[model samples]
Target: MELSAGKFLCLFALLSVVSAEIFFEDRFDDEWEKRWVKSDWKKDGDGAGDWNHTAGKWFGDENDKGIQTYPDYRFFAISAQFPEFSNKDKSLVFQFSVKHEQKLDCGGGYMKLLSGDVDQKKFGAETPYSIMFGPDICGYSTKKVHAILTRNGKNHLIKKEVPCETDQLTHLYTFIIRPDATYSILIDNVEKQSGSLYNDWDLLPPKTIKDPDAKKPEDWDEKEYIPDPDDKKPEGYDDIPKEIPDTDTKKPEDWDDEEDGEWTPPTIPNPEYKGAWKQKKIKNPNYKGKWKAPMIDNPDFSDDPDLYVFPNLKYVGIELWQVKSGTLFDNVLITDDAEYAKKVAEETWGKHKDAEKAAFDEAEKKKEEEEKANEKNDIDDIDDDDDDADDTDAEDSHEKDDDNNKIEEEATSTHDEL
Candidate 1:
């Protein structure tokens, strides 16, 4: 059991690396139900949507399954707890993969990280969270990654618009926040957005603001252009009427002044008339440029050294209202290493993406063919109905003719008898 100093240090370093890389991870294996708790928040009313553990209708691997929203127009709430940890002086990376199998017309595909203990059964939208990140899609207007951070009991949304993947295929979304107050948003392992927390969120007042006491001088010539003093209105400019009687119009042949209400000619816009004129603008020599209040350091602004810290993060939850369901969430990872997250994304989403696309395309093709076949069947049914109606009409016509013949025969026989 004796070991050299170098060997012991190496083993300790390896253990630290492994521990630091992964804080919480879930591939959503068969034992997911043991770890996850489905909330009964909306179960009594309107019914809470259920989650299906499957790889979906089309996927690269059948066994690579995830939890999917099963029904449309229902609220879903679920949470899973992990050993509590904090990102006090470390880089925090939160990532997951989502596939909007229903095309996600309007719904939230985001996940929340909650601090402290949670009432899993009651976990819903009202439950507080330390950080919320992922894609949120709604029609054509809203398709962006949400990166919200909670500070002082208030949630602050990222000010920058970071667009996300809206495709039906699976996509990897990664959000990374560092101890230095910088953050990044990645979609499919590509950096979509990166900036400082102070600049991106309104957690603190602005560092600089327009000087409240400063004002533009009363005689400051801010206007860049002024009316030409030499310009004057023409003598006949006001004389041209906007409308005049059309000379091409003629009086009707049957026109009677008393009967036809004087037979006035229709009016037309005058060709010679022009809109109201203004003196041409010329550059002003005394222009002092656009005046602005000088900026000064904001007195209300106070930077926090621990802006990126989220202490006691414990649970990860999914709580949202979906208009149309079929969003699959899997490969959830919370770590301190960005590279490890990327590797996880590449192994799951990247490795299987192409095969998944191929499967999706095949499914689409099959669906299209089925739709066309159904349309054809409907058309044939309509044709068959028309043919049946025609046959019935022909039979009715023949019966009517036989009745006419019988009546004519009876009349002839009576006449002959008479």
Candidate 2:
């Protein structure tokens, strides 16, 4: 048998495809060996639980079945390392099952692929490319699975509402990350939705820090935005017509550096005290500064002319002028005994007259606009009737033309027979 070059190449390609297996699973159910790293993700708390050898369980917080009991209402993440991914391999699949003793209120306990190694001390950095569980209280999240894939390393928020069931003993969640960087999630082996993560929500910045006014430090500005070098599309949007570069966009410079500075070592109020401040209750009486409280004007005070106080004493001088009783008092009244009332009335009358005229003018303008709107409506009604007549005539002409064409066809057939 003679083997051609084409046949040999096809065989080689087939062998390469068959040799690709990137998954590692711990199927032995061994309780002693730490195959996966476990951690209590309760923000700031220690992982607490006892492993039940007989029941093969880990218990903590509240749901303390024989196998699993956690003291804090936090999720214990277990992960295996896979440092073998290259740019060539695109699709990755993850499968897992979870059983809850009772329904939970807190939105916790979901599995994801972390880019970095995660353990008790720190949560590894991984774009939440997949979510297979839900917080029990967020209604109707039974086997709710959400799958996300990284094209340029941004998460596209997609909400998949699964049918709620609290009594289900165990639920299986599966995800298929495709070659094109799009992903699909399946709950109980049923795929509800699939989308391309290369465009749209998948490539957006984190929702919490997307706003320009958000609290972000100048030094750590790079952490806030994940720049995408490859993808820049305007899919799943109406306002945007084309892709735009987000490279030039940066955190505002005006952000306070002092406030945003990382926690620094504090200087002791008195370093001479060789111990904790509380242990040495040394009262330094020299610290005599009391915190000042701002003073507010008395609200009970009234701006009334009747409340004014007057003394029957001779004035130093007389700058003679007559003014109205309600006229505004001048500061010069202390030195001069002038009739300031007359000057105030003359000055204030013009302002009062103008205010009255302005009110009347505004009312007149509003009335005129209303009348104009009514007139316009009447004109629009007449125009609408004319438009209807024109439309009817155009329709009649079209129908007549169609009828004439049919009659001509009949006459032509009869002539041909003769």
Candidate 3:
């Protein structure tokens, strides 16, 4: 009962797809309100901003909608729960697409993966998370992806500078952590950073450290160069003055020696004078290399086989404070397969990225045209004001001429009468 090669390959593909488990996914469709819960942590203080369900002001597809943060200078907190799962000996992947349509000046576009059931109504910056991954933008100083992982009640941030997309366009961010403790960060399906969790985070003590007992020997000559004793100072070096009187100077014709001080020529810098003298340097014959304590195995370091595991992950959330909100989050996914996540990104962000960019460019061009039109209108207004001022000046001149003619007529009548 042997199967054909084509049939075997198809069966294999089906089995592969089945093995990749998706713990949670959200396209933020019409039923998104049912799936998501908004926090009321700042509602009473009038600091909580609302979330708008739309594709944004400029988007490729109206149907391809997501949840967006609304208004400026407010806090936003929202969460969605899924069945509990663990990534003890498996790969864990978190991915989503975000678009900072407001050209986010200072805000976070990152998402969080919660380990347990969290109070969705009070979910804010204080809520603990197992992993936080995505872009965090704040002017020119901070424009990098934040990859933070929580272990043993402590959250550890990745020690790598991973740059993110700063444009006002949709970008897919993917974070994958493997059982082997290696992690990778992808922006728009392209790998931007990858390293071991042990190296990137302070999850565990370092494997090696400098030997504590090792110290520099007392007689060790660590200096590479020494002053040359054979190099001597030139004769009459100190006698050469730093300044010399200018020989071209002549006495002034109107010099008052009694009233003013005696005339002295101004001094100029001496070209022949060397400011200071010092001995030259030469390589030391007994020079030893720079001293460093030898490295040895750290006694406190103990490797954990499950450093990358995040057990009981049951929720995904977004908690942020945006000074200018317009960050749209969509296509959130948590899975055990990298390929499946990549495929999802491709079908969503990849398919519409170019169209979105084109739409954004068109909007920017329209805005520029409007600004130029406003500038032209302002100039026209200024010119109109100047023309009115000139007209008033002409009227005033006419009034003055009439007054002068009346005075002249009065004066001529008086002279004729006299």
Candidate 4:
């Protein structure tokens, strides 16, 4: 039986489709309320734990509805439980969109992947998560992605610093964990960081390390250069002053000799000054190479090729502590196909991210224009006050002139009668 080329190609495509799984997705539609469980955790002293759930695009973009945390210094959590699945020998993608409507001054714009008997009601910052992936910002600095993957009961944070978007617009953050123990972080469908999980995270302690017994050999001259023993400092090296009085300065003519004290000229950097002299350096002839401790097998390290596997993945949640709120999370997806995540990002976040940015820029421009207009109005008010003051002065002068003319007429009339 001969199989045609067309048949073979079709078989390949079908198998590829079968290998990947779309485990979970939420567009946060109107019915999204039923899907997510908002935690009842309270802030300090019984403050309200708020989560602002929206039923449409944020700021009027075409993306779906999203949930936003509210109130300054509050604890928020929302979770969705799903059928358990494993990500062994297959790709895993955890993707979502975040918009810091308040521009995120010290807050988290990330989500957590929780599993193993998660009580949605009890979920909070204390609840354990399998993966926590997204951006975190604080103060003036500290704007980076926080990718924490839990393995063997310990959460290992990615050592490589992956920068995150700080703008007020919606951004898509996707974390891809491949079957080959490699991971990639994507911001807006573009790869920001990619490397082996083994190298980037301390998922497992180092496989090998410097031997504890090794030590540097005696008399190993590691210095690259040393001061020349024969070289001497040039004569008069100490005589040069670091700074000198400015010879071009002349005393002001208004200075009084007796009343005013003598004035001194401002000091200037001395042109004849040379830096403190020292013996010149010479290459060390006895220099040896840098010392390195011999490596030996680490007894504690045991490599597990399936270090990236998660057997009982059940839920994906957004559990975070936001100092300043107004962080929107939506378009959450958990799948085994990398391309599917990218497509969803494009159709949703990728589609509306630019429009969100334009809206933000437009708002900023409008604010600046209003400020300028207000300043101009203030200046105009000041000018109007000045004009009023001048008119009052002119009125007073006219009144005085009339009074003087009346006095002179009265005196002239008296003289004519006499």
Candidates' TM-scores?
0.86, 0.35, 0.90, 0.75
Error of 3 at 344 (Å): 0.8
* Candidate 2 Cα lDDT to native: 0.38
Compose the digit string of candidate 3's lDDT tens values, residues 256-288. 998887999999999998899888999999898
Better of 1 and 4 by TM-score: 1
lDDT of 1 by residue, 1-418 (tens): 9999999988876666576657789999999999999999899986699899999989999999999997999999999999899898899999999999998999999999999989999999899999999999998999999999888899999999999889899999899999999998999999999999988999988999999999899999988999999999889999999999988999988998887778878999999998897888899989999999999999999888998888899999999989999999999999998877877888899989999999999999999999999999999999999999999999999999999999999999999999
How accurate locally, in lDDT, is each candidate?
0.92, 0.38, 0.92, 0.85
RMSD, candidate 2, Å: 44.9
List clash counts for every candidate, in order. Answer: 0, 20, 0, 0
Off by over 4 Å in 2: 1-20, 40-69, 72-75, 117-121, 124-143, 148-155, 159-165, 204-418
Which ranges of candidate 4 are over 4 A from the true structure?
A: 1-19, 43-48, 55-63, 226-281, 361-418
